[model samples]
Target chain A: MKRIFASAHVKRLFSALAALAILELMTGPPGSALTPTAGFTGSFGEASSFFGIFRTQRWVVFLFLALAMYAIWSAWLMWGTQVRAATAKAVSVPRAASRTRPVRWGMAVAVLAVALLLPHLITDPFWQAAMVEQIAVYVLLALGLNVVVGFAGLLDLGFVAFYAIGAYTTAWVTGALPTAAPFGIHFNNFYAIPIAIALAMGSGIILGAPTLRLRGDYLAIVTLGFGEIITIFANNLYGITGGSQGTNTIPHFSLHVGPIKYLWGLTPVPYYYLTIVFVILFIAGFKLLEHSRVGRAWTAIREDEVAAESVGINPLKYKVMAFAIGASTAGFAGVVTASQSNTIFPSSFTLQFSINILVLVIFGGMGSITGVVLGAIVIQTGSMYLLHTPPAGYQPQDLYIYLGALLVVMMIFRPAGLVPSRRRHREIGLAEKGEGHMNEVLTGDTP
Target chain B: MSDKIFDVDHVTLRFGGVVSLNDVTLHQERGEILAVIGPNGAGKTSLFNSLTGVYQPQEGTITFQGSDAKPMSVIGKKPHRVSAAGVARTFQASRMFSALTAFENIKIGAESHRGIGVAGAMLRGPKTRRDERTSDARTVELLDFVGLRAKANVISSSLSYGDRRRLEIARGLATGPQVLLLDEPAAGTNPSEKLELTTLIRKVRDEMGVSILLIEHDMKLVMSLAERLYVLNFGSVIAQGTPEEIRANEKVIEAYLGSTATETGDRS
Candidate 1:
C-alpha cells in the first residue's frame, strides 16, 4: 500500500539497503584475487576487471543475501518495538490489583519448581554445569552489586575487589595455594564459606570506612583503586597468594555431621543447587532489609543525604553497612566460583568482570530482586550460549558489540530497565515529568 | 535560669573573617513561643545553625537542660548528636525526603531517636518489632496532628507547598525534642496557610509543651504568635521584650522596621 511506502520503517529499510550497497561496492568481493598493488597502476584493464567481477553471479548472490539479512533485521526491530510498547501500555494497570494472592503464589511456586528442577531437566552436562551454573555465579555477583549501586545509590566501580578477596580467602583456607598456609592448617570449602564472607566483609568495612565519606564519583574512583590494588596484590604476592598462576585444587564443600556425610565433587549440579539456596536466602534477607528501618534509611539517604542526616540517619554508617552487605554476597559468589572450578586466577578478577556484573544489574533494573536475577540469567546465559555455539559467520567476540548496541538502545528507550522496582520507576517517572529539575531549582541545587 | 530551656551565651559564629553571628546571646523560656525577627542578612539562620551544632560557634557556649536538670554545654557537638540531645529543627527550605512517603519521612525521625540499631532492624526481634509498631503508631499520630493523615502514604514531593511545610513540622515533632527551632516557617505560604501554621505553632507550644524558637520575616505572624520577641539587626539583638514593648521601641523601628515598614505597616 501507499502507507507502507511512506512509513518511517520503509525509509529506514531503504537507507539500510543503500548502506549495504555502498559496502558491497567498496569491498568488491570476499577474498578477491585483486590485490592493493593492482590499484597503483591506474590501469583501465584492472579497473574494468574489478567491475566485471562485481557483475558476476557470486557477487550478485552475496549482495542479495546481504539485502535479505537487512530486511529480516529491520522487520525484527519493528516487531520488537511494537511488542514492547504494547507491554508497556498493559503494565500501566495497577500491578497489585491485577495479580491476586493465588496467582502470585502460583507464580512463586512455579519459579521455585523450575529452579529446583533445572539441573535435573537439562541432563546435558555441558549446558547445565558449564553454561547455566557458571552464569549463576555472575547472577549472585550482580545481586550483590545491586545492593551497593541500586539500593544505596553508591556507584562502586571496584566491587570485584570483594570477589577477589572472597576467592583469595577460599584459596588461603582450603590450602589450594602452593605456598604454606599461615597456620599450616587446611579447612573444607564449606567452612571456608563463612570465613571468606567474614574476610570480605571485613575488607569491605576497611575500604568503606575511610572512602565512604567521599561520595559519588570520588567513592567510585576510590573503589576502582581498591579493586586494582587487590588485583595487583594477587598478581605479585607469591608467598601468600601464589602470584599470577593463582591457587588451584581447592578442597570441595564437604560436611561431617553425626549421621550425614557428603562431599561435593566436580559435578556442577550440587554447586548449582548450593548457589540457588544462597540466592534465595539473600533475596529473602534483602527483601526484609528493604522494608525494614535500615532499608527506609537507605532510601531516605539515597533521595537526599542532608535530609536523611537531619532526621538523624548517619550517612556513613548506613553506607558502610551497604558496602559490607554487598561485599558479603560477592565473597559468597567468589567462594562458590573457586570451589566449582577448584582454582582461581588473578586474571579472572578483572575490571571487565566488574563492568559485566554492573551491566547485569542495570540491564535487569536496579533495586528489583527479580529484575537483577533475571537480568543476570538472560545476559550471562545468553553471552555464554553465544560463545559456546556462535551463529554462522559471527565470532564469539561479536557479543560485546551486540551488548553495546543493546545498552545504547535500552538507555534511549527504557532507561528505567527491564524490571524496575516501584521506587525506581517512580523516580524515573518524576525525572521524566521534570519534577527533579523543579526540585533542583527550588532547593537551589542548580549544579 | 531554671525555666530557661535553651540559653545561648554570647555565641559568636564566623565563617573565616566574615562574622555571621557576632556575640549573639538569647534564651528561650520552657514551653514558650519566642520569635527572632530581623532583616534578610540579619544572621538569624547562622544562630539556628549554631544552636543545632551545624556550625560550632567560635566563642561562647550554648547550654541545654540535660536529663540531670543541670544545664550542660552543647557547643561543638555534631548535628545528629544535637538532635539526640532533644533539640530538633526544621530548615527554612522544606527538606523532607521528597521520594519518601510522608509517613516514612516521619518514621525516620522517630526511628532515629528510638535508638534501633542495624542488628535489631535486620533481626526484627520482638523488641525491634515492638519499637517499629510503636513508631508506626507515633507516625500515624503525628500525621493526624499535622492534618496530613490522608496524605500519609503520598510521596512528599507530590504534596502541595503547604502540605510539605506541615510534613516538615510533623517530621520535626517526631524527633521528640524539648525545644524546636523553626526557620522562616511562614515563608512562601499564602495567608490561609500562614494562619494554619501560626495556630499549629501555638498548638505545638501549648499542647505538646515544646518550647519554640522561631525565625520569621512575617512581622504580623511574629507579633501575634510570639509571647516575646527578639529584634535583631546586623547579628546583634536591638531589643527583647513583649510584642507591645517591641512595637513601641524607636531603636528597633529605626534599625529594622524602617526599611520593611510597608510590609508590616498594617500593625497599629
Candidate 2:
C-alpha cells in the first residue's frame, strides 16, 4: 500500500504539491503570503457577525488547533524525510525503502494547510494577536536551546537557570527593585534583554568551567547544582529579588528601529512580532554557526572526545564553550520569559523546567535545531493543550500519561530524537540518534 | 633490531613497591621486526606501555630517531599525545570503540590526517564531508589492505578473532605511526592462524613502512618473525641477541631447560 505512493507518478506529483504547501507554511514562504494564525485568532476566523453558536466557535478553535499541529508536524515531515533521503542515498537507495510517506504527508498538508490559512482570511485582531504570540514565543525559546544542546552536545540539566536568568534580568534590571526609588532608575526592557544575555552567558561560563572535563553523568550533576543554586538565590534574596512572593508590574519589550518604535506599546501583537523576529535571528545565527566550523567542533566532541582530542581538538575548551553557548540560549529565553508575563517567581525556574528543556533536546534529537524546534512546539504546546487542558475531571497524572506514552514510544522506536542529527543517524542508527541527526542537518557535520 | 631506532637508557618503572619494569633498554630499526618473548610477568607489555606513555618511568630517559635530544620520556604523557608523536600500540585485549563500525573506527584512527575536528564534522558539508569521504575511502582501503574489507560495516564486537586482530592492526596503522606495537599477535590463535600471522607481520613491516615491537610467547613464531630477540626471564632481560645467539645462551637454557621441558608446556 505504501509502495504505491512512491512508485506511482501521479501520487508522487500530488505529494510534491503537498510538499510545496507544507514548506510554504513551514518555511513561511519568504513572508509575502498572509500570516498564518492559530489558537484564538484562528478560533474566530469563520464567524462574520458579532456572536456565533457555541458549536461553531468550538469547531473553529478545534480547526485552528489542528492547523497549529499541522504547521509543526509539516516541518518535521519535510526535514525528517529529506534527511533520511539524503542519508539513505549515502551508500545506495534500497528499492524497498519507504514509499507511502509522501501520500500520508500529502493528506496531512492538504487538510491542515487550508485550516491554518483560513484564519488569515479574517482581520480579527484578537485571534491574530493570540495565535501568533503562541507560535513566536515557542519558536524563540526552542531555537535558543537548539544552539546550546543541539549543536554543542552538552547535556544541560539547568538550562532553565538561564531561562530564569533572562527573565529575572529583565525583571530586576528593568523594573523597580522595591527600594529603587532612591536610585532613580526607570524600568526599560530594552536595556534588560542584552544585560540578561550577558549575565546568562557569564553564569553559563561559570557553570561550564568546573564541569567541562566530566562527561555525561557528571556534567549533568554539576549543571543540576547550578540550576538549584540559581533558584535558591532567586527565592532567598529578598532585598534584590522579590523572593518566594514573586515580582510584579514588570515591563514589556520595546525597541526603536531607525526612529520608529516598530514593536512598542505594551500589546501582545507587537511582542508577538518582536518574538518572531528574534526567533528568526536566533534561527539564522544558529544556522550559520551550525554550518560553520564551530558546529562540527561540537559534534566531534559529542561523538568521541578522546578521538576528537587526539586529532588536535581541545576538548576542555570546546566542551566549556558548548556549556556556555547552551546556557546563553536559556538566558535569552529568560529575557522574553520575564517580558511576556511581567511577573515571575522562583517556582518558574524549577527542576521540572530543566527537565522540560532536556526533554526538548531528547525528543527533538540531540544536535539538531530543526528537531528541537519541532519538539518544543509539539511537546510543550501539545502537553499544555492535551494533558493540562482536559475535558474537565483531569487527573494530575494525565499529563504524565500522555508525555510518558509518547516518550516511551519514541524512545523504544526512535531514541535518537524525534528529528535527529544527520551524520549520527547513519553512525548510531535511527532511534539512538534521530534528534542528533537534525542537529547535524542544521550544523552540517564536524568530523 | 637494527642500530637504535628506539633507545631506552636504563629506564625504570615502579608502581609503589612493586617493580613492573626495571632498567629495560631496547631498540627496533626502521624496517626490522623485533619481539620481546617472555613468561606472563616478564614486563614485555610494560615496556610497550612506557614507550607509549601509558606509564611514566620512575627514572631514566628514552630516545627515538637517533638524536642527542632528551628521550621523549613517554612516562607521563597522555596516550593520544604519545600516539601523535609517532607511536601507536594495541592492548592485550583489543582496545577499540565497540560502537563504531570498522570503517568509522579506521576513519577515527585516520582522524590525525583528515584534519577532522568537531567544527568540520559538524558542518559535514562539502569540505568537511569530502574529507570524511576521502578518509572513509582510505579507511576502507586500509581495511582491505589488512584484509577486513568484508567486515568494514560490521560493529567491532561482531568480528571474529582473526578479523578483530586485523581490525586492531588496521586501526593502529590508520594513525600512520612510524612504529607499530603488537602486544601478542599469535597468543590465542590456532597453529595455522599463527603461521598466517607471521606472514602478515612480515607483510606489515615490508608494506606499511612501520617498524614493529611484538610481544609473544610462541618461541617458534617469535624466533622466525624477530630478526633479533630480547628474552626477559624475571623483571629484566636475560639475553638480547640474534635468535641463534639467544637460543644458545645459558640463561635462556636455565630459565626453560632447567624448568624441565614437560613443565614448561604445562606452565605456559
Candidate 3:
C-alpha cells in the first residue's frame, strides 16, 4: 500500500475515496432484509430520498456531500494555522482598541440600546411572541444553570425541576392551580414572585443538602432522577397540579402601585419588555457576583474542594449556595413565563428542557454571561425559525440530529465555547497543550 | 490558656481493618517550627488530615489554641471551621486552582476571611469594594513574600514545580492562619530551590510569627529547619524531642535514619 500510494496526492485520493464510501453507506438506501432469507440485498443505485425532487441516485447525492466535506476538511488541515492567526489578529485588534474604560462602556451601552429597541424593530406578532417565550425565557434558564455548572462546577441535570417548582408556586399563589392559594389571597402574578423564588430556593437547598456531597457522575445521576421525579409528580398529582391538563386561569400582570396603573395584556411585546428589564437586572447582579468574594469561594470549591476547605471555605455551604442562587433565577423566570403564557403544562418542564438549557450554557461559553445570552438568542431564534419555515426533508424531529451534529463539531473546534470566560478559555487552552488534564477541563474532575 | 498552638493526644484513626494512625500524640508550641518525619505509610499525612478535620479519630482529643483565641476542640468540626480557628494546611501534592491566575489562587484564600454575603457580593456596596481592595493588597503582599509577584497573572498550572510549591505556601499564608501546615514542601524541588524553601520556612516563622507543622522525607532539610522533631513508625509516634535529640535517639535511627542511607538517600 505504501508503494502504491507513496505520493501525498495519491494518499489523499485514497482517503477521500474511503470517506466517500463511508458517507454513501450511511446516507444511501437501506438494506432489503435483516435476516439471511433475503441475502441482505440492497443497492446504493436507488434514488436519493433527500434529492427526491431531482430524482438523483443516492450515491450521486452522497458523493457531492462527501466531496464538499473532504474539501473543507483538507482545506482546514492545510490552512488551520493561518486561519487561526487571522482570526486572532481580527479579534485582538478590536479588543485592544476597546480596552479603554470609556470605550468599553460605550460599547456596552450601544448593545443595551439595541436590545431595548429589538421588539420595536420586529413588528411581526409571531416573531415577537417567539422572542419573549423562547429566547428570553431560555436565556434566564441558561444563566441560572450556568451558575451551577459553570461557576460552581456542579453538574445539575434537574435544573428544570426548579423552574417547574417556580411555575407551580406561582400558580398556587395566583389561584390558578387546583389547590387553593396560600392565605387565600388570590393575588396577582407579580405578588407571587417572592413566594415562588423562596419556594424554588427552598427546594434547591432541600435537594442540594443531601445530594451535593456526591461528586461528578453520581451527583449528575441524582439530579437527573430528581428532575424525573418532579415531572412525574406534576403529571400524576391531579388535585394539586391539575395533572396533565395544567391550569390556565393565571392572570396577566398589572401595576396598581401609586398611580402607575399599567396592565400587561396578550401583546407579547409588553412581556418582552418586562423580561428584558429583569434580564438586565439579573445580568448586573450576576456580573457583580462573578467578581466578588462569593464568586471566588465558588471558584475555589470548583477547582479543589480540600484546598478550599483548608482556606476556610465550607465546600457544601458554597455548593448549596450555588444551587439555591441558581434556582432563584429559574424561579423568577418561571413566574415570568407562567404569567405571560396563561397556562403551563408539566410536559413543558421535561428533562430535555434542562438539557436544552445546558446546551445553551455550554455552547455560549459556560461561565460568560454575555456568551450565554448570545447563545440563547442565536439557538432559540434558529430553532424557532426552523419551526416557522423548515426546509425540504427537514422534519421537526430531525432538529436534534442537526443540533447534535453541530455540538459535535463545536466540541472539536471550540471546546471552551463560542464566548468562553477568560478562565475557562485559558483552562481549555492549557488542557489542549497537555499542561492540564482534559477531564478536569471538560468534566470538572479533580484527578 | 495553653502556650501550645496544638494539643493533640491519643489520636487513633482506622480505615476498615487497617489502623492508619495508632494512638498518636503530638504537640506544637506557639511560634515554633515543628517537623513530623517518617517513612512512607508512617501516617504523617493522616495526622495532618486529622488535624485539618479531613479524618476523624476514633479515640483522641485535638485542641487548637492560637495566640489570641480560646482552645477549641478540633474533632467533629468541619475542615473549614478548623481552618477558621486559625489552622491552615498545604497538601502532600501541590493542589492549586490550575486555570486561575496565580494572584487569584492566593486571593481565594485571602478573601475567604470575613466573606461578604451573597447580597453584598451581588450589590457591590462600598463595604464589598473595600474588602476586595484589602484582599487584593494582601494577596499581592503574600505573592511578593513568596517571590512570585512577577508571575501573578500567569495560570497556576503552567508554573514550575518549585514555583508551585512556593505558590501553595503563599496560598496557605494568605489564609492568615496562626499555624501553617507544610506537607512535603520541598519534595520535588532542586537543591537550590530546597535552600530557598528552607529560608522561606524560617522567614515564615521568624517574620510572620506563624507556627509550622511540617511532614517531610528530606532529613537534611528537616534537621536544618525544624526546632522540634517527631518521629513516626507504623502509625505511632516513636520519638519526640529537639532535632539534635532525635538525631541521637536509637529508636529514631533504627526506625527512620538507618533506612535513609539506601532508600530516599538522594533526597537527603
Candidate 4:
C-alpha cells in the first residue's frame, strides 16, 4: 500500500484522472448543444462570461495539462536511470558461451514438438492453411536470405528472383499452364522440386558469375535489376509463362510408394507437415554449413576480402557458392508455395515480398537460423492476426506503419537483432566498447 | 631445395604517372632471411605487393621456384593463385579476419592449401573430414610455434598488438609456403616482443626451411636478423649486399639513414 502510494504511482494516477477530465471537456457535455453555449453580449458582458467559463472547464484543462507533463517527465527520468544501470551491468559482465549441446538439443526438441502440434492446435482450416502458406514460406525465404546477407555479408535485395524461378519451374514441369507447358509434360510436384531447385541454382550462378565482383551497393543494384528482369520476363513471355494470366491448375504434392498413397488437398495441414519437414532439413543443413570450412571462409571474406585472398581463399568461387546455396533454399520454398496454391503468377513475385523476407531476417537477427524462424513466425502471424481481428479504426495496411516504426526502434536500440548470432553480438559489443574507449580518451580518463 | 627461391627481375609498377617501383630487381635464396629496408614511400611495400600479385608490374617478370623445376611467372596471376604457388605473405597492418577466432583464421589458410570443394564441405565426406582434421592439427601446431596457443580460440580482433602480428605470421605459415613474406612484422612490438619475433623468424628459416623475404623500417631489427639486405630510395634499389656491407655503404647512410645514423633508434 505504501509503495502504491509512492510519489511516482500517485503522480501517474493523478495525471490519468486529469487527462480523463480534459477529454470529457473537449468532447463537451453529455448532450450536443448544437451551438455556442456561452453567449457573448457587449464587451464588458463578454469578458465576464468568458471568465466564468474559464473558471470551470478551461481551468480543469490547465490542471490536466500540468499533471500530464509531470507524469511524462517522471517516466522519462525513470527510463533514463534504468537504461544507464542496464548498460553498466552489460559492460561489466564477461560474455559466457551459452551454446552447450544439451541446451541446443532441448531447444530443438521443444521446437519439434511445437511444429508437430501446431496443425492440430489450430482447428480453423483457413488460418491453418494461411499459416503454412504465408508464414512457413517466408520462414524458408528468410533463412535463404540470411545466408546471402548474414553469412556471406552480401546484401541481396532481389532474392525473390530465385523464388519466382522455382515457382515457374514447378509450373512448367507440372504442366500447370496448357499453353506454356513444354511438350505438354506433366510430372509430380515432388519430382518437379529437384528440377526447380537445380534451375534456381543455375540461375544463381549465372547472375552471380558476372556481378559477384561488384561490392556492396553495386551488387545490390545488380540483384535488384535481376529481380526486375525476371518479373518482366514472366510478364512478357506469354507463350512459355502464360504472362499476366499466370499458370494455373498446377498439380498438388502427392506421394505414391508401394503400399500407401497420399495426396495433399484443400486442407493445409498436410502441406504444413511437408513444409515443416523441409524446414527441419534446411535448418540442419544450414547449421552444418555454418560450422564447416566454407563457413570459415565466408567469415574471413566478410571480415576482409584482401586478407582472405592473401590467405589463398578464392573469394569469387565461395561467393558464387553462397549465392547458389542461398538460391537453392528459396527454390525449395517456391516449389512448396506453387504446389500449395496450385498456381504461379508473375504478380506474386514482387519486390515487396523480397523486402518482407529480408525484414524477417533482420528482425530475428542475421546469421541466426532460430532467430529467422522466430522472426518469421512473429511478424507473419502477428500481421495476419491483426488483419483478422483489428481494433476499432484500424486497417490491415496500418501493419506496415507499425513494422516501420518497430524497425527504426530496433535499429536504434538493438542493431544486432533480437537473437543475434554469437559473432555478430561480439562485433557489436566490441564496437560499442570502442566508442566507450573514445569517450574515456576525450575525457582524459583511464580505460 | 635450389639456391634461388624467388626471383624479381627488373619489375616496374606504375599507378597513373607515379612510379611505385621503377625497374627494381631483387631475389631470395632458399632458406635464407632477406630484408628490404627503405625510408617511407620508398617502394618497399610496392615491391611486396608486386610479388604477392596485388599489383602487376608493367615490365619485368616475377618468378617463384616451386617444388617443380620450372619457375612460375606470377606477375599477372591472381593473389590466391600466387599464394597457392608456394608463396604466402603477412600484412604490415596485421590483416587478420577480425571476426573469426585465431584458430579458425589459421585453419582457413590451411584449408585453402588442402583444397576442399563446396560439395565436400557441405557433405563432410571422409576425404573432407580427414583434410579438416589434418588442417586443424596443423593449425594447433602453427599456433604453438608462434606462441599463441593460449589465444587459439580468442577472436583475432581481441588479440594484443604483438599477438595479432604473431597470429598473422602463424596464418602465413599455415599455408605451408616455400617462401613467407613478412612486412614490418615487428611494427608496434616492444623490445622483448621484437627479440621474440627475431628468434621466431630465425627458427622459421632454420627449422622449417621456409625462405623469408622481409620489408622493414626498423634498422636494428633488419641489421641483426637479415643475412642479406637490399636498400631502396626513390623507387630504386640504392644498395644490395650483406647487412654489414650495406650498413657501411656511404650512399645507403646518406639517402636512407639521413644523418641520424644511430642504428639503435626506433624506426617504427
Question: What is the C-alpha local distance difference test score of candidate 4?
Answer: 0.82
Better of 1 and 4 by lDDT: 4
CA lDDT, every model vs. true structure: 0.80, 0.66, 0.85, 0.82
Better of 2 and 4 by TM-score: 4
Q: Estimate, for each residue in A1-447, the C-alpha lDDT of model 4 and write its tens digit.
A: 777777676867676666555434433322335634321111111235533444443445555566776677677677978887888778654333236667668768987998899888989876897788889888888889888887887878899999999998888888876454556668888888899899999999999999998777778889898889999999998887889889778889888999889899669999988998888888888887888888888877776788888999888988998899899899999999999998888998888888898899989998888888889989998888887766432456667767886788788888878789877666557656652111111122221
The true-versus-predicted C-alpha distance at residue A118 of model 3, in Å, is 1.5
lDDT of 4 at B136: 89
Query: Candidate 4: where is the Cα deviation over 4 Å?
Result: A1-98, A178-183, A431-447, B262-268
Q: Mind giving the per-residue lDDT tens digits that candidate 3 earns over A99-182?
A: 888998898899989988998999888899999999998899899998988888889899999999888888899899989898
Arranged by DockQ, best first: 3, 4, 1, 2
Give per-residue lDDT, candidate 1, residue A422: 76
Residues A1-447, candidate 2, lDDT per residue (tens digit)? Answer: 788766645454565555444433332212333634321222222244333343343334444455665555566666988877788787454433323678655754674564345345635655444434444455565666666666665556777788888887777777545536324676568777678888888887777777776665566678888889989999999887888877877776666668876545355555655665566566656776675445555665565554444443456666677666666666776777567767889887899877766677678876676687778777766655653344322344556545665777687778678887664455456324332222232233333
**Model 1 segments more than 4 A misplaced:** A1-94, A97-101, A131-133, A432-447, B66-72, B116-119, B259-268
Top lDDT prediction, candidate number: 3
Top of the candidates by DockQ: 3
Q: Can you give the DockQ of every candidate in the order shown?
A: 0.48, 0.13, 0.67, 0.52
* Tens digits of lDDT, candidate 1, B1-268: 3578888899888888888888888988888899998888889988888888778888988999844456667786777777877888888888777767899989999988666466666667788899889999999999999899999899888998888888988898898888888999988899999999989988888888888999998888888899999987888888999988887888887888886554462652
Which candidate leads in TM-score? 3
**For candidate 2, what is the lDDT?**
0.66
Worst 10 residues of 3 chain A by lDDT: A37-46
| Between candidates 2 and 3, the TM-score winner | 3
Error of 3 at B148 (Å): 1.9
